[model samples]
Target: MAYLLSSERPAVAAASRNPLLAILRWAAKLRAERHQRLAFREMLEFDEARLEDLGLTRNDVLEAMGASAPQAGLHLQRRRALRSAIWLGRSSF
Candidate 1:
């Protein structure tokens, strides 16, 4: 493990205890989560033909949004990958 010099240690400790820094970090997290939700909303707006072009159904989007984590896009990607794997397995038969 890397050890911080005494001077650097004090600065790091002070930063961690800073209330403003904590709030800023919290606000940034909220903003990032909001952006993720907005992106999903935009995806939901796409018509069936457009969604089909993207290789995803409206149900896929809904399922992704239903995930407890804020990363709906990650869920969608996982779902798409699972579907692709299933299709590939069927084709190999």
Candidate 2:
């Protein structure tokens, strides 16, 4: 039957019968999430002066690591505004 030959048919049939494959996929996803969390932790360990030298604040790093998309967008806008204001102030002196 044409239904049996459809591209979508084999993958679903194979996945349902293959428990090991499902487990491997889950493990890989978990590993990637752990790696991201560890990297965020290392960034947080940096001191304030060091973070400032990188043009980032603690809040910025934390938001980038864990916040939702909307929250991150707000933070980005606020950061840009602050930088613009600071630059204007410095130039006026």
Candidate 3:
């Protein structure tokens, strides 16, 4: 997974130029936010096979969908940490 960090001031100013795009972006963000919450709540019960049927790996779908920077940032960090932990565990073993 890749982590993207936009320069905050420029990013906001650029987004402010297009009202319609901004609204559409907001709607997409809302949808993704809802999905993330649902995913967390149902984490144990989630099915990877079904996600593939929907034509998406969880990460691909997430990047396509949209998310607030804070939420996305937290997720990125968590994923990085988990990957690091896995590597460390393998080395220890």
**What is model 1's C-alpha RMSD?**
6.1
Question: lDDT scores for all predictions?
Answer: 0.77, 0.68, 0.58
Clashing pairs in 3: none
Q: List, residue by residue over 4-67, the lDDT tens digit for candidate 1.
A: 7765664565565778989999899888877877877899999999887676889988888788
TM-scores of all candidate predictions against the true structure: 0.65, 0.49, 0.40
> Model 3's lDDT to the true fold?
0.58
Cα error of candidate 1 at position 76, Å: 0.7
Residue pairs with backbone overlap in model 1: none
**Better model by lDDT, 2 or 3?**
2
Regions of candidate 1 where Cα sits further than 4 Å from its true position = 1-15, 87-93
Residue 39 in candidate 1 has what lDDT?
A: 76
Give the Å shift of residue 69 in candidate 2: 11
Compute the lDDT of residue 79 as modeled in candidate 3: 56
The lDDT ranking, best first, is: 1, 2, 3
For model 3, residues 20-79, the per-residue Cα lDDT tens digits are 988999999898778776764454245788644433346743653365645664654555
